[model samples]
Target: MSIRLTPLGRMVVPVLVLVGLIGLNGWLSATMGRGPWLDVDKVFHLAIGIVVSWVFYYLLRQKHDAVPHYGFFGAGMMLGASGWFPLVSQGLLFSALPDWDITLFGIGSHRNPAFHSALIPFFLVIGLLHYRGMRDFAIGLSVGVCSHLLVDLCQSASSHPDWYRPNFYPIVRGMYGPFAVLWMLGNALIAAGLAYGAAGRQPALVRMEREGFE
Candidate 1:
């Protein structure tokens, strides 16, 4: 059965979906009794975030005045490179003989509690900038990022495995492959959305303009 949702309703649906995904990940981590499961949970969480962003954009495009904001995409790319690229490329900085195992001040400290704390602002800022003058984008990204942080906190409280420690750490090594998948999915969806916006011939935002929430 097809039931139509109001603009706000449409927006809230996706946000709720993202929340449920994050919560599920945390719960799964708790169930697994380790952090490796948490990484798997996060991969799903990131995928949900990508989907929510897509839906939010689809809804926002419905208005006549709703212009595709190329700036947000540009900003997202820059934020990824400047803030996230370094962390992802940590392996590249060291020799192949042995992985770096230093503290936050040195190698092998990438998953330190201090580093996680520092990541909050970075992710939040990127989320906010992803919105880039659009309420839906801002809301979606903010919720997604906050949910992620909560998941992290939950995992931490569970005393799960960390990235730096091996014997004590429960997480699977080199799980970044999953993150790569999520990141690639997000980028692909964003590119499609931008293309749709630019096409301008067939608008993707199918809602009525009179609703005032394009």
Candidate 2:
């Protein structure tokens, strides 16, 4: 007895799994309330990290024709790089990187403008320009970091209205209000557009048939 999934199923399964995980997290958050181990912020960060990484994978996969074909190994490598591992690791690291100044130099608050600023991504883009080979990986890391900051900003606004400023420290300070919600929606729209564009670009079964793998 063998089971086969259609191309649509292949895509839908991962989405369904993600939704299920999110639902579980919500349930846990509601039941557990606030605790050191089950902090809402931590769970939210992990969930967003995973989802963003998955989206990044599809985005990179969309340009199948443009990039080199490493086949199964490439797919696995991308998964490991963008999925929970690098996304969560790099995302958490970059997000916290900004706070180090507080402990080390005691110059500014934890949410320093230098690290959390939107300009950070532009700098990352410049790095990619100079180092072309690391484009995909760099993009994945940047997305992770940016997404983390966006979520943190939203959380900070909702939880601590007094300190809801979104700008980097000492530069300009203003409330984010509902901008984070809009930003999340924008991210979803971008992911959907990428997936729609890549939908039938190169079905694996078709490739298998052509390559005599079936």
Candidate 3:
């Protein structure tokens, strides 16, 4: 016999597990400080973000009275973009929006404000989410961003080579200072601009129907 969880339970149990994994990693990092055991090999944890995506998807699906959950229709544009049509185009890149600094400009730093800091984009998430038809799209886009952070957090917690800074700096990089600026703008603007465009798009057939082309 297998134990099954309810929808809410499904969401809650995994979150608790993720938190515990993070805490365990923290405790190990504090005691070990990148100890010799990992000196000969590297460890990268990518599973956490995939797990957390469920929570993100769940929260994004909640029915808000005013905006309502747009379901598949609201998120159709992004799903297609991230899906097999082109198979992971811009939507996948949005997951790494913060890395634009190094990838595009060749600037590498411990922490960059442009993309790492959440001061501005935090609010942009709320603003974009409130738009009439953007709820699911915002959720899809934000899951990518949040998963980006979760991957960093996992790296920092484990003291992996990719993120050797202290947990505070690597996890949040809260006070770091951005094309350095554009990273932050990139984070928000990419999501907002994409969502805005996707939201306004009407299929050509629909437009033709309205204009009597068909």
Candidate 4:
């Protein structure tokens, strides 16, 4: 699971895993319930998180040697987990991060919008991660946030009744296609933008070294 591969191979594995899992989930729902069962949201989220983390990781690694070699990596190797563990674990951990609002902040509804409303703390974490030389991990977590918000923000009030309430975020209730999709995409784009900014920044040491060279 922790094996490194050629770039093409590394990219292909996640897609394959996503496809296979989706198929398996579909099969399970078909046989177990015997009727319509489209409840593989978390699986899709997990795959999105893993795949997007890789996307950001690859982009960040292109110009920065500070980023790790994809497998058996930690923010600074402290996690010590190997293979796909680094990315996969991050994907799983951060994708569900937004849901913590339910218990921690006493939010009555699931997938509450209050989490993203607070931008100051998110910015603080970004700064701290940059200082710790873990901006790549920050990018990974951003991808997960994007994934969570993409799904949660896309649902219609008709589907998720809790969305009926007045909340911290805008509610674009629809049939889960046009308006909802566009709204979700808009939020996700901002998350992607944040990740892009993180990837574009160089570590202080790296920046100083480049200046010295120049």
Residue pairs that clash (backbone atoms under 3 angstroms), model 3: 114-183, 114-184, 178-181
List pairs with backbone clashes in candidate 4: 2-83
Task: Please state the error at residue 69 of candidate 3 in Å.
Answer: 7.4
Model 1 TM-score relative to the real fold: 0.34
Assess each prediction's global lDDT (C-alpha) against the native. Answer: 0.40, 0.45, 0.43, 0.49
RMSD of each: 13.3, 9.0, 10.1, 8.3
Q: What is the C-alpha local distance difference test score of candidate 4? A: 0.49
Model 3 lowest lDDT segment of ten: 80-89
Sort all candidates by lDDT, best to worst.
4, 2, 3, 1
TM-score of predicted structure 4: 0.54
The Cα error of candidate 4 at residue 114, in Å, is 2.9
Put down candidate 3 lDDT per residue, 1-214, tens digits, no spaces. Answer: 9998898898888878778766765665566554323411112122343454455445434532222244643233222222212212233332244444444555444345555544333454467543434545454444444444444543544554433333323333353222322343355445434433433332442455467764
How far off is residue 34 in model 3, in Å?
A: 20
Ranking of all predicted structures according to TM-score, beginning with the best and ending with the worst: 4, 2, 3, 1
Residues 15-80, model 4: lDDT tens digits: 787567557755664665332223344445555566566666776777765653243222311111
Query: What is the alpha-carbon lDDT for the whole of candidate 1?
Result: 0.40
Q: CA lDDT of 101 in candidate 3?
A: 45
Residue 160 displacement (Å), model 4: 9.1
TM-score of each: 0.34, 0.48, 0.42, 0.54
Candidate 2 Cα errors over 4 Å, as ranges: 1-7, 30-40, 65-114, 132-136, 149-173, 179-214
Poorly placed runs, candidate 3 (over 4 Å): 1-3, 12-47, 59-95, 107-110, 119-135, 160-214
Higher-lDDT candidate among 3 and 4? 4
